[model samples]
Target: MKKPMRLSTVAFFMILAGVAALGVAWWTQHKLGIMPCELCLWERWPWRVLIVLGVMVPVLPARVGRGVLWLCAPVLLVAEGLAICHVGVEWKWWPSPFPACHAAHVVGRTLAERWASMPLMPSKPCDAPTYLIPGLPVSMAVMGGVFACVVFVTLCVGMVRSKKIRRF
Candidate 1:
């Protein structure tokens, strides 16, 4: 017979998944030199929060730990919503909510003044989507949306199963 999954195991998996996703973002930014847009940076925040919750879940009481895990589902859904919004911005279906999506315009009159006012490294425009896989039509934002949905579904299922297990 297969052993049932424990809350701690699920939390650990969440932590590992969050770390792995962040690690890929770090690698792409540092190694591949792909600077993230403002929306892209916003997407990372949910994973960071989830990772923190995952760490705390193990130390809390069983019922409380499961409640914390249950809380992750909504956070993942919100992340998914953000990813969808970003994908829409990338596709030109909607404008980005952030001003960083627009190109920087220097107000200085002189060329020297304008050049001095410009930022050292140009921030990536939110409208431009980064594709990690070569020759693939999918953007990183789409991938993030799909991953968020998967994680959200997993959390939902785990929560249901955990409740059923508790009943008996």
Candidate 2:
């Protein structure tokens, strides 16, 4: 295959790896019926962006696509940082800023009205330790870290390969 085509294939695999990771998270949640906290949703933003970049790199212009791939570095870094912090909070290594993951439960006689007044809440805490892989020492956040590292490595490799191919 041509260099661009090969690079595109690698990009597709990177995105698929991300999707598979998320899928495992979702499947774990489904089987266990666990929900993500508000902060957890926030943790997803970077991965979501990576997923988009993975899809776009193959289809978009080279310059724009390269820029997007480069952009993923910092994004994943921050997200990984947030996930690490979140895991720390869950492990009691630190206190989470958002003490409440889900919305506060309604109280008072007007419970129905209170419920009605409750604001729309996110799926999970941005720092909630919801990863329950039996016998495993790692949480979802840790797994996210692993994925980010893999993606960064893959992106770097792709960049190098593309540069070499361009020169040839």
Candidate 3:
């Protein structure tokens, strides 16, 4: 084939990857009652960027669109990196880099003072990983890392093959 990538196909895949990641996260949070930690929420930003890129793709010319889509490589890497960091934190390899990931200290002599010092909403700790399946070994963060890696590799292969053709 002269071109392995069609503009529509690129756009569709971009949106698909983003939506799938976000949708799964949302489902686990709302349906399964799994709360996300601060780092987990931070990890979602790259997917959000992908969603925005997908929406912008169809409007651009084919070559320009493909060029823009190339940005996905780094974006995916960022997503994967965040997931891996989250996994490391879950495994206790190291402490979470985000301060928000730590539990707030409620120090006060009086009960009311302590209560007032505590966060209004109870935030999940980054070290506690969320497991979806009952017997599954992998945590959600690890799964997310795998997902990002797969998408990144797929995009790279497809783009590299297209680059060989020297036309977008």
- lDDT scores in order: 0.87, 0.70, 0.88
Candidate 3: 10-residue stretch with minimal lDDT: 158-167
Compared with the true structure, what per-residue lDDT tens digits does model 2 show for residues 43-89?
A: 77776777887888877887777777777678768777877777787
For candidate 1, write residues 115-144 as lDDT tens digits. 988877789999899999999989999999
TM-score per candidate, in order? 0.92, 0.74, 0.92
Native-referenced Cα lDDT, model 3: 0.88
Off by over 4 Å in 3: 1-3, 161-168
lDDT of 1 at 34: 95
The TM-score between candidate 3 and the true structure equals 0.92
Q: Indicate whether candidate 2 or candidate 3 has the larger lDDT.
A: 3
Off by over 4 Å in 2: 1-5, 102-106, 109-128, 165-168
lDDT of 3 by residue, 1-168 (tens): 555666567667878999999999999989988888999899899999998887887899878878888988899999999998999999999999999899899899999999999998889999998988889988999999999999998887766655535446
The best candidate by lDDT is 3
Error of 2 at 148 (Å): 1.6
The per-residue C-alpha lDDT of model 2 at residue 58 equals 75
